[model samples]
Target chain A: MNSSSYYRNNIAAVYIDANALQLEPVQRAISKLTHVRPQTVTSVAEIPAAQRNLRTLYVTSFRGAALSACPGTRVHRCCNYHTVDLYAGCPLGCSYCIMQSYLERSAVTVYADPSPAITAIRAQALAAPEVPLRVGSGETGDSLLLDPLFEITRRYISELADLPNVHFEAKTKTDFVDHLLDLEPKGNAVIGFSVNARQFAVEEGASATLAQRLDAARRAARGGYRVAFHFDPMFRSGSSDGSPAAAAYRDVARRIAAAVDAGRIAWISLGTLRYTPALKAQIKRPYIHDEFVGCADGKFRYIQRERVALYRSVVAALQQYLCPQPPIYLCMESDTVWQRVFGWLPQQINELEALFAGAPLRGESV
Target chain B: MQMERVATLVQRVGPLDIFDQTRLPPDQLIRQGLTAVLALAPLHDSAAGATDAAEAQLLWGGPIVRRAAEIGVGELPARRLGPLGHRDALMLALRMEARAGGYSWSEREAIHRYAGEHRVALDTELSQLVTAAQTFAESMERYLALAPIWRRAVEAGAVDVRTAELCGALPPAVLDTVSGAGRRLSFSNRRLVLTWLSELCGRDGLHEPAAVELAQNVMQSADPLDALRRLRYPRLSAMEDRFAALQRRLTQGTPLELKAPPEFEGAGYEVQLTLRSRDDLARAIEALQRMQEESDELFELL
Candidate 1:
């Protein structure tokens, strides 16, 4: 379903913070698009407890500096990256969403004020001129869900054009990127789509279908904006013959390879589904099954054997589709898993960061 | 002689009892007014005042007042009070207390008119008394209706008498005040839960004793609804608690980011590391190495 369906089916009302009301253009645009009366709330707490399941659009003033280091735990391997908190929640109710337990409030809250975020990015870019700083907006929420109404990505693209050192990633599970087509190609920004196997894409209740996401990635690639894919939360399906998870990953990779030149693909990240102990209770009952097992990292994860097998299958599939495979990284995995999957682990995290920041492959014009 | 005869007649008439001038019927003493007065008389001392009589008379009329007076003034046991009886007693008490000293003649007249319109025996102007009586009756009925289940529960040895009594006295509607989901529990579902609790208590061996303890614990819990949910979904509750405890242990004393699936359903967990400078990257690497060294204990959760 399209983003409009998310608004129609999920969002019961739209609440705008009073200070955010001052941004008349954004407020009026959202109101007109959603066809919902903009309720003026002084704070996020003003949204009634009863309407929590309904998505609440908060256009409140953000005082804290937006850009910060990704809050990684000590027990897992972390890719040294910074995250820009542009939004607080996502409407796409992926059964595996960490925010279900991480966030106190259920409603999607968008910070109307982007000035502070922009300032922080600029300062980081100026300070670390030599270091390639990858700052993404999808850390706490989906990056592009509200782009059609708020045009937040457009604002970011226009504002961050001067900062060449900072690479901005607008990550999403949606194909709503029509607003970005006409904007000047910044080369510094990447529109990353979080995709999954077909079964999961349909079952997770994400806004965009796999085909729709691939189409959006193709379009972004053709438009000279680099595209990235994240096969995150890879499901360990039980298939006796050939690995069903492998075939699914291969199928999606082939589709992506056919849709756009493989050279335009900047990076592909593989993260197996793992959950903190806190999220087990918050998970929907139907979604809870016997597939998950406790892992040493204090989260539920597939056994190492299963994880390694799934990663190997997907990695092999990806190689067959793309001529020169893009920089693929394992998310939140250990040194042993890295060594087992990719044959080696980087001595320094900066080496991996440098690889992502280096260059895109030269390909035939689409 | 005519003037003296007239004077003697006036004097004789004047000597007659003026209090008996109206010459009320004997039955009038047990009419609506006296009936109300006698009904409420037991609530106070035997030597009742005109105000008490007036209040009781106006609220319950003669027959109900007389019956209430016969019952005497003590807290009536819920078992002894029938629905209609409870309604009449509660309404009478509420109305009398609302206008304790007495009401004005005009107020009394308005009450009488209302009572006439409503075709009730008593002249009660207090609409709230009707609402209060209905509320009380419904509560009492609900409690009594659930009494058998409580009795069965106590007999099954699933719960103590105190817990059974409390549960019996409380209506299912009390769940509505506790939690949002509790409000949506259908009548049948509520009964099923009670049955399930009783069954749990009656289970054999260690499970039975645990169930009994759980029942007692639920009764003593600050949020009974939450306790009930835990009992209903034991496995889920235990898993959640274990998961939370694991998170606390893993995150202790380190800035390492551990990312897991929403419900730990997927294959891979992500460890995210953020670095501002090359030195930060080096520090992150050192931490990762330390984590790698502790992989045996850490990977057990997988």
Candidate 2:
């Protein structure tokens, strides 16, 4: 187990589907660490309603599409990345987390067995021998929070190490990559960290400090793995560009540039803080009070002009500080925003730079 | 199966002494004479096995009983249900109150308060008796928590349950400003107004009455919704205003139509020229040439 991994301490109970008990990976992983003994059930659905919350960890076999395409918002440019669903819910209670409105009443379910997901991802990578099939496991949950116990990333990193076109990235806000350091021939596996300015970083409940995450990123980079940074849901620091918050964002950019070699970066994504209609009612954070307006899409974002300005400032700092420019893309942004930031809309997926390019381009056009 | 009738005996009670308007109102006595009101006077089972001369609770037709008292009727016709226990009395009171059918906002507030105080279940035991969805304890608390203006607006059919729930989410200090702004707009506008104002109050950390003066001052605008929106989305609204000014300057009195993306949220800006003749086409070309000069400023809005 990784020294920094805060496993089962937060987990009050462990539940496994009765059928999933037959999987060797589930049985072995359970025997390896978990002090909270597993209780067998007919299914994860059998977990009592009262205990079905973030505190409980339900281990079960993922019965649905383990790997699928990112369902990018309509009218926004999608990164065309795919996600694996080995984990169903997140326990990190970031106030702005979208899952709060959806998974508030459910357990943090971990799909224990990785063979099925590994087989599925390998098939996709083999099927498209040329396309860079970027797949990550943090779409619905933090990638490394409880992963040290289950060693889910090790299975993917080891099995998919030979697939040059398959970039298997494990995205996390935690500083728990110590256990992953021993793996050999790590292939094109990348460890992505979600970074924020100092003030906002504190608000990401239970997430590592910015420095801690950067240190972890440096560690992963040193271990023959590329690293990516996501400056996502960037909270507006000030009305004016010179405000303390805005200044902190640039300093954050400077720090990232200093922390690792520019060549090790896979990609960096920027997104302004936005919310669904449901979050507005339940969220009580101080930053949510900023000036926002409903976009053409149903989500509310910081007014359009403000978002463009923030993106320009952050991208400028990242471009200048890093010796070699990394592929920085705006996540789920309108084409107008893309035009404003990069001066051109990426009509082809390859235009996103090395992060997305080299995928076998079939007759299909993105 | 035949049902057994509930037995009640007719009794004459002192008119002004029956003061429980816990159920029906006193308006029933206006044009109609007193059709006996149901009264409850708990009889002590140990000694005083008879009804006391003290005021009895009017479980039904309180309006008739009170109106009879107002008309100088010395005595009122009433029906007495036998001895009632403490729990049975609470159940009967809440049940009869719900039986009044369509309740006003205050009436729902009142019943819910009584039901909550006595641990009486309104949703389950009285589900059939409840005509309004707002009668449930959880839903009633939402409406009851609203500011008086919003509650009145809700009562007058101006605000909706969802909008009221939105207002309920605001800090207690900001609800006044948000709901006050919402009160003036049309139904849909009321929703937008309240939603924006609440968000503004939350995002800016404007908690105290003094801090929320911008919203309060905006109330004096000729159009409250427009003013509140301008305050809520200062940057977007300012950019929109600036773009309009720029468009006017560039068009220079030509029928040249230029538009930025909706909410300035998209990447494309559009230019249109409605032409009817060759001279119109010439003028349109002239305007297009003019628009080309400041395309940077215009496209910046998009």
Candidate 3:
């Protein structure tokens, strides 16, 4: 770490990779800064074994369960545990990434030093004694993409697996599960993938093919790993005036059931397209755009009436397919959506706990 | 904050139909061609003659004079029909009449329509003014509804304790500001009338000494309206000073205090309660409606 170039801001340390300056445009920006100058350092392998002075940049975030308890839980994804932000930015830039709005620091840089992040995770787990440490590393960044280069996934599995109380969810979109095939699969180590219907997978999401994602999931399941699927950013596509939304939803369900077993699934999360003001602007393209997304009430994603109906249709389809259906939760949705689609409001944490313990829904906490 | 005053004020001024047109007063039906021709032309006798003769008569005599008469209806003979040449004055008088107490139903509808129109200068100050007017109504309503609860606590010989308890029921933003004052008694005594009035109805230019004196007369009370009237003039110089000091200490440069947005408070509260309370869904739903009403009041003000 070059002291002259690197300095700490209030919340985050500013690290300008001098190597990034090799690019002429990037270097020009660095030269424009008055105080700081980039310094060239060795590549990943050449980093010295013992460099005590080098202040490591660690991702410090609340655990999911702890986050769930926070007063502002609805806004935050309190996934019932701490999740790792494996990488900074996603390569697969979907039309509606919430990260675009929330994260001001937009770079595709992975924290090269995983030890500091791992240490932070361990410390967090140690701080909470009785609560099962549920930590994930895919919040700020995609969990996979740089898996082969950084080998962070293998490290996460090997290092965090020993802590029996800790659970790690490796969420990704790319079919990057080869690295995990040989590693001992801990039941706590949940492998997850985000999938939409084929149409969305093809048009909006220009990532791995639907077949490739399904193959990856099946392989993970075969390897005795618990799997989860995120039907996130559920694209609302049809004639502009809203016709045949139910068909689109039915297709989405059929694809999910065909791809993976319901029993092997840990949890399925359904999130409709929600956008913040900034993200909406960032994702707005000049031409070849869907105008419906822009017509929303201030800073809200305006999915059409048919789209909401389609969401309900998709939820219904999933309920019909996934036998002994895995717990379905709507992500970042209003209570109105919950009632209109799910027909019941979400159970409270205690009620959810009771449901978790196989208690009947007593209609008390509707 | 019930916005009862704004509603009352709007009613006194007239109907939504009156404000819908840019022309002030009910009868001054400014010719559409006149407005269009004025936008392009300058002030001159020749330009005035450019309009059709019959249209010119409607513009100058019957409608304009009638409007001038309407505005001068309650004024003394000296100020009556005074400065009829100034359209701005007419607009200001009309605005005052409509928004004196608070937004009337017609004024609410007119303002809403105005906001939707491109002509209205919907800048931040105006936005804040509109928002403050709405929140004032909402906060006062909440305070009034919960008054018995607060009064009970005070009569029990624990004024501070009861105030604290009542404060708990307030939205976080209000509670935070009230708490920072070391005692909400200041809010109850001095700031409440002004702040609440400012929120429910805009300052209404009562900040002017003459205007303040006029309003004091109209309100028929020197005790409460005096403080409320004082807010219109002077423009809260002391509160601004205190706010600056507090900003330096707490927020530094960054905005530490989120303006208690009256719209989302109820939605947020009900959403949380509905999720949390399973058995009393009906009670939660009812509370949600009250919150929605409060939110509706804010929109009405807007």
**Highest DockQ, which number?**
2
TM-score winner between 1 and 3, please give it: 1
Docking class of 3: incorrect
TM-score of 2: 0.76
Candidate 1 residue-wise lDDT, A65-87, digit = tens: 68887765445555656787777
Looking at model 2 chain A, which ten-residue stretch has the lowest summed lDDT? Answer: A355-364
Please tell me what DockQ candidate 2 reaches.
0.38
- Ranking of candidates on DockQ, top first: 2, 1, 3
**Model 1 misplaced stretches (Cα beyond 4 Å):** A4-9, A102-105, A238-244, A284-288, A347-366, B1-302
Docking class of 2: acceptable
Error of 2 at B301 (Å): 2.4
> iRMSD per model?
10.4, 2.4, 16.7
lDDT at A308 for candidate 2?
84
RMSD of model 1, in Å?
18.5
Q: State which candidate, 1 or 3, has the greater lDDT.
A: 1
- Over 4 Å off, model 3: A1-39, A42-81, A99-106, A123-133, A163-165, A202-205, A238-246, A285-299, A303-308, A343-345, A348-366, B1-302
Q: By TM-score, highest first, what's the ranking?
A: 2, 1, 3
- When only the first chain is scored, the TM-scores of the models are 0.89, 0.92, 0.67
Deviation of model 2 at A6, angstroms: 3.3
Q: A1-366, model 2: which lDDT tens digit per residue?
A: 233345646777788888788876677667765467778998767899799999888888767887888766766767768888877788778889988989978988888777788899999889988777889998989888877777878888999999998889899988889889989889989899999988776568888889999999898888888999999879886333325365677888999988999899988889988888888766767676676767756889876767888898998999899867777888888777777777776554343755545322222354
lDDT values, one for every candidate: 0.59, 0.72, 0.46
Q: Which ten residues in a row have the lowest lDDT in candidate 1 chain A?
A: A357-366
